[model samples]
Target: ASNAYGNSVGRLVRLAVIILFIYAGLLGLTGLGFKIVPGGFLPTQDRGYAIVFAQLPDASSLDRTQAVVDKISKIAHETPGILNTVEFAGFNLFGG
Candidate 1:
C-alpha cells in the first residue's frame, strides 16, 4: 500500500509537469508566427531602439525631437507586429 501510494503521487506529479509544459508550448506557439518577418522580434545586436539623453547639448528642440518621435511612431505603426507605443516626456533633469 505505501509503495502504491508513492507511485501514484509520483505519476501525478509527472503528469502535472507534462500538462503545464504542453500548455505553455501551445501558448508560445501562437506567437511563433510573429517571431520572424519585419518589425518582429529583433536580436540583441539590433540598434533599432535608441535612448537619447535629455542633457545632451546637441539634443534637438522639443519640436524637432517630437518630429523624430512622430516619424518613428509612424514607422512602428506601419510595421506588422508593433501593437502600440507609449511615449513620455518629463523634466529633463529629474526624470532621467
Candidate 2:
C-alpha cells in the first residue's frame, strides 16, 4: 500500500496536505493572538511623571485652590515613589 503511493502524484498530494496544515496552524495562532492582545490602539510605555488635578468651582479663588494644592503636594512628597508634585489648579493647569 505504501509502495503504491511512492510516486509524483503522491508527492504532490502530500505537499498539499502539509501546506494546508501550516495555513490552518497560522490561522489558529492569529485568532489566539487577537484574544491575548489589549484593546487600546495606543502602545503603552511608562510615564515617570503624573499630573494631579483639583477643581473647586468657576468662582473659586486661585489662592484658595493653591493652598489646598500645597497641602496635597506636601502629603504627596512624604509618600514613597513621589519624586515631586506639580500643582495644577483650575482650568489653565497653570491656574492663573
Candidate 3:
C-alpha cells in the first residue's frame, strides 16, 4: 500500500542509480574466475558427517526394534572415541 506508491518518487530515482551501480560491478568482474564457479556448490564433493539410519518393516515389533537398536548401540560404544551414543528405537527412544 504505502510502500507501493506512498513514498517519494525521489526514492525511485535513487533506486535506479543503485541498480546501475550493481550492473556496473557485475560487468566489471567479467572474465575473472572469481565471477563464477563452473560446477555446483560442492563440485569437489568433500563432505563429512556421521549418522546411522536403519529401517525395519513398518510392522516390526517394539521388542525386535529394541534388540536391533541395542546391538547398534553396543557396537558403537565398543568402537574407540565414541564418547556418547544416543539411540532412537522406533518412535519410543526413552522406552515406552
Candidate 4:
C-alpha cells in the first residue's frame, strides 16, 4: 500500500500544472457562489410573533393613548388564536 501511495504522489507531482488549474477553477466557483447567494446570517421567516402599532392624532393625551392600547390589548386577548398581547403605551417604535 505504501509503495502504491508513493507512486500516486509522484504522479500528482508530475501533474502540477493540472492541479493548479483545478485549484484556480475551484476558487473561481467560490467567488461566483458569493455573488449568487443572498448575504444574511439568517433567512427571513415568520416566527409567529406579530407587532401591532397604534397611532392617534397629534397632541393626544397620555391617558387617551393608554386607553387605546388597553382596548387593543383586550380585543387581542379575547380573539381566538392569539396567544398573548403586549401593550406599550405612548411608545412609537418607528418614530424614533
Best by TM-score: 4
What lDDT does each candidate get?
Answer: 0.68, 0.80, 0.76, 0.88
Q: How do the candidates rank by TM-score, highest first?
A: 4, 2, 3, 1
Q: TM-score of each candidate?
A: 0.34, 0.45, 0.42, 0.51
Model 1 agreement with the true structure over 11-80: per-residue lDDT tens digits: 9999999999999998888678557545546766786564443343355577766666677677778988
lDDT of 2 by residue, 8-95 (tens): 7788999999999999999999999989997567556657667777767778898898888888899899999888666665556464
lDDT winner: 4
lDDT of 3 at 34: 56
Q: Write the per-residue lDDT of candidate 3 for residues 34-93, one digit (tens) a residue.
A: 557665565566543346766778789989989998999899889886777878777743
Q: What TM-score would candidate 1 get against the native?
A: 0.34
Model 4 CA lDDT for position 26: 100
Higher-scoring candidate on TM-score, 2 or 3: 2
Error of 2 at 7 (Å): 47
Backbone collision count in every prediction? 0, 0, 0, 0
What alpha-carbon RMSD in Å does predicted model 4 have with respect to the real structure?
Answer: 13.7
Error of 2 at 41 (Å): 19
| Cα error of candidate 1 at position 18, Å | 38
Clashes of 4: 0
What TM-score would you give candidate 3 relative to the actual structure? 0.42
Off-target runs (Cα >4 Å) in candidate 1 are: 1-59, 89-96
